[model samples]
Target: MSGPFDGLKVLELGRFIAVPVCGQLLAEGGADVIKVEDLDGDQTRHNGPIMPFEGRQYFNKNRGKRSISVRITEPEVLAAIQKLAAAADIVLANFRPGMSESLGLDYESVRAMNPRVIYGENTAYGLEGPMAPLAGMDMALQALTGLAHMTETGPEPLVNPIIDYAAAMLMAWGVSTALYHRERTGHGQRLNVALMHAAMFLENNQLTHVELLDSWRGEFVRYLKHAFADGKTWADVIEHRETLLPHKVVRAYYGFHATKDGTVGVACNARTQRLKLMSLLGIDDRWTSEPGWMPEDAHAHADYVYRQVATAFAQQPTAHWIAALEERGLPIAPVRHSDQLFFDEQVKANNFLAEVEHEVLGPIKVVAPPLRMTETPLAPRPPVSLGKNTREILAEAGLGAGQIDGLFARGAVREVHETLEDLL
Candidate 1:
């Protein structure tokens, strides 16, 4: 078997991040995902006016999926898409709310043809709300949810596109789960995912008991600073000790530190780990005049402890700290950039990445699926050129060559081609 979802076929009408990511996940997991876009291609493919800078923006999210470009506004093209959707086991769409309905590509229309189709839709908010008609994205969702307020003192959205990826993961999971349910129940269902909901779920741990923060001051004030110079967030400071300690007793302890050469994150929250860290750092407990020190005052104690530990760690390089602390079971690791994963021995050893050959770009490295199924061997889908499989897809839909040619002639279908101007 190619994968668990080897026989499954999905039709994707997604652009940007969220829906495309869902299609990517499904494709990576061994599903045949067909990404349908308009004649100009996905909006993301044009990152900016500068041609050089507009490097295939669709590569990351639409990897492992076949692309089909059609003049979606044309009735003939729309009919072809509907025919494809009718044969698909799953349909993933993220059109601006009612756009799908206007185009006659909505769930109801597709489900009319294939009653067993898993119809999933991604929206900015959700169905049945005052904001349902409006458009939204990751940043908008962050602000809509309490993420902006809770993460930052004032209302400032998170810089990262966290919510978009979150929604993708959730949508993928939802589709898989829905498929499983259908297997037993012999029915398909509609799945709706919203960016706002994704952001809220991401903050499940942080948003709890947030009312207690009103009393914290001094060193606890450190959590209020979103930009901690070193890039650690406030949630990183409290971590797992959120509810265990009272506002007066809890303090910022376990987090990343900027070392001389780089950064290292340390977890020395427990008393034994604290002693272990102190001993490794060559700092005696007598420095604070408390042999078995447990700070009674959160502000003063946190300030004193962080000062000593930070100063000591800053004097040494990340490698030095790792060598001293990692083997000691002190739970310390160097803070590394994402790009560094390309060179990480552990990641490569685990086969977390794969190499795919692109016709124009040549061979390129892609992040493989993070999961491994012991029983089923899965081969990921490689990225394809826009409308690269249009003829084959239309043929599979039982269209004759003459019909396909006619559609092409009428400007309903298009195959991607790079011109000299495109290179320039």
Candidate 2:
């Protein structure tokens, strides 16, 4: 069977992660994706550890796509881009807020060229807000959306670019939905996905605050404002916030515990699991087991339970706890570093990784397509280097050999064929 997007064509004007990842998703579904880049290529090409120009980050997200390198500032190059846009079924871009308008690839311009084109856009903030014009990356969005503040060692940003990945998923979903809507009614619409919005979506459960039921939320906000006004440190604010947790579940039931050898995560949320864990730990705290029995000193009782669990777990090795928890059918796992997954039996059995040959790096492993389909399975494709497919794409766009050479002569377009040392 053919893939879902076998005959679709996508034009991607993106750098870094979010929109590039969205384009990758469409390509995995068997769309023909053409990525437009400037002379230096995507920033990630220079950011990773493997090479001076083409690196791991670039390989991960730009796979299964063709690259067309051009200086869009030149009129001839802009015209060529317009021609490509006119022929595209979908156009994706994650340029800064006003950069697209300047380049004439904004939704309005692209719509004028191809009204039925599904346009997917990513921005740091939504289009119609005070912060719309401002530039933001993953860390900034995390701070703006309270993700940083909510972490355990909080008021600090997470090292991972989770917000970018979330935005990419949202963009791909929106584009797929748009494709469906177009199939039904022959209409195309623009999709705007913001990193801030994605961050909020990631915290949906915590962000849902009903005014009547969550009255404490407003009071907490007021307290934060007061704390800011009083020049209190972030540590002080977090310390104050800790005292106001609504669900005062005994701390022993959740989080990581250090065993004799390594750390293991334990989550016993259900009553039965909690009881089983308590029995194994040899504890009979009436405050936790008895229904509707509130401890007089809640903090003191919680501290005691937590210490007991911690001490008991630390007495044994991580493997011991893993075996014990699995036998009991409780939710538990040993803390394993990310590198371990590359050699993990379960990951290999599931085909979570695929090997692709790189011109410079030889064979390397990368994450496989996240989804699977019974009929139309995705095959891995190696990513091309900067401007690697420029000539072929221009030929497909109906540019003659002489015209393409002229563009190359004028420094408007380029096809890079370089050695590793030359790239460096």
Candidate 3:
């Protein structure tokens, strides 16, 4: 059976992660996704932990989509792109606020041509905010949304651009929902997903504030502000914040422990599981059972238990701990590097990775399509080269061969015939 979105057409005017990924997800669902790139291509195409012409970052996000390179500033090129947008069922863009409007590819412009188009827009911040016009990136959004401060080992942002990916998921979900709405009402709507909003989505549980129950929140903020203004170091600020915050009694049960061979994560949430773990390590569970636990006493007992557990865990290898924890029905997992994933038995069993041969990079494994459907399973497609479909896309847009040749001659469009040398 064909995938659910087999006949859908998607036009992606996106750079970097969010929009490209949204388009990718749609393409995985069997949409015909065309990624429009500037003459220089997406910035990520040159970003490297791999070949400069097609970096891993670009490879991972732009899969399953055809690419067309054009200089949108040229009126003819703009008109050609508009033709694609007009025919698109869904239009995705991640340009900063007003950037789309300037390019005449905004929701208003596309909606005028195709009323049934679901236009998905991604930004660093929301469009109406004072910071909307200012450029935003994943790390900046993480810092702005307190994720940086929430890190245990000082104010460090995650190496991965999680917010960008999260925003992409939101746009994909929002666009899918809009498609359903259009199916029902015969009308399309615009959807906006901001990285700041995605940060909030991630921290929703942590961001809850009830004046009666969370009065310390205000005091903590004030204390943090005063501490920062006084030029206090992050360690100093963290120390003060810990004193103000409520005791995290179960924190010990939900943390990584360094074993003899490697790290292992343990998550023993239930009382019985904690008791079992304590018994296995030959540590006292008296503090957990006893009543009238004073703050100082509880802290001392917890510290002792934690240290004992740590010492015991360190005595064994990660594999040993994993087996022991599994035998006891406790939750535990050995920490493995990303490189190990391709060879992992569990990953292979689940078919989580798919191998494809790239024209330039040769055979490689990539993350498989995320969802699984028994009837209409998602299929992984090989990566397309930059400007690989430029000529075909222009032809599809109703431009004749002569027009295409002229566009190429004027440097208004480009095509990658067979190799990265085409771009160079």
Candidate 4:
């Protein structure tokens, strides 16, 4: 079976995460994605361990795609890229605000070349604004959007480039939507996304009502201190808190807990589930959603109740708790390291992780597409070597063998050579 985008062709002029990840997703969904790289190649080529020596982080990000190397500064290379873009159904780029226009790869120019082209552009700040021209990445955008202030990890960016990945997912979704639209209307247009925009999207709830949220969050923290420690009293902080905010205290009997051997998170939010948990732990059902309970009293009650729950959970190993909870139909699972996901029974059974044999890295596993459509199942090929399709792409763009050789010889283009693996 093939994917929904089986016949779609895409040309990618991108580096790093945002644009490339979108191309990667499209390629996985069965679009023929071809990356157009500068002569030296994408910066990610040296990002992790070098290729053909075993370890490569790039493989996870750039799979199921072919690539061609071209010097964007050369007239011949620029013409070649234009011809390729005109033939493609979609073009992806993550350039600084006006860089695309300067390189003649902008939406208006490419649309003039092929009005049906879906041009996807990702910028650091966005298309228009004072911040548009300035360079930005994952960290700077996170801090600006209040994500850093909200996180305990300080101003350092999240370990993963979550905003970059999110922006890419947005771009991919836009491309899919545009493709569907073009199928009926035969028109395509520019789609834009920004890292800052993705950051804000991620921080939606927290960013929406900043001042009120800040106050509520601060009140929650103070409640915790008063309820758990003797450092402060609820009455002392009552003046600074909204009386109604106490109703928002959603402490659940369902949450993560440290078991005797490991950690397990449970979900017993339902009344019956909570009752079952109380029965299992041999604890009395003492929680009440008493409508008029004072905020101070409610916090104290929640803390005392949770302490009992935690004490009960710590009496058993994680596995024992999981088995006990699963039998009761109270949703529960042990906390696991990410690497353990590779061998997880449910993950393997669902085939969310795919194993492929690479020409350079041998056999390996990659996260398969999370999306499932029975009729159009995706079966992505392994990631291709850098510039592996240089010759093939140029030929398909209508360059003769002589012209291709001349371009290569003049340093405007490069072709992959498998024998060069020794150089690494």
**Native-structure RMSD, model 3:** 2.3
CA lDDT of each prediction against the hidden true structure: 0.77, 0.86, 0.84, 0.79
What's the lDDT for residue 1 in model 3? 75
Candidate 3, residues 299-404, lDDT tens digits: the string is: 5666777888889999988888888889999999988788898789999999999887788767878999888999887777777777999999999998999999
**What TM-score, computed on C-alpha atoms, does each candidate reach?**
0.82, 0.94, 0.93, 0.84
Clashes of 4: 0
Query: Which residue pairs in model 4 clash with each other?
Result: none
Better of 1 and 2 by lDDT: 2
| Location of the lowest summed lDDT over 10 successive residues in candidate 4 | 148-157
The lDDT leader among the candidates is 2
Weakest 10 consecutive residues, lDDT, candidate 1? 243-252
Q: Cα RMSD for candidate 4?
A: 5.4
Error of 4 at 165 (Å): 2.2
**Candidate 4 residue-wise lDDT, 162-245, digit = tens:** 899899999999998998899899999999998999998998865554574455776566575565365444354443354535
Model 1 residue runs over 4 Å out of place are 48-54, 146-159, 210-252, 269-272, 282-297, 418-424
Rank candidates by lDDT, best first.
2, 3, 4, 1
Model 4: lDDT equals 0.79
Q: Please give the lDDT score for candidate 3.
A: 0.84
Clashing pairs in 2: none
Model 4 ranges off by over 4 Å = 52-55, 148-157, 205-248, 251-255, 268-279, 282-294, 297-302, 419-424
Model 3: weakest 10-residue lDDT segment is: 289-298
Q: How many backbone clashes does candidate 1 have?
A: 1
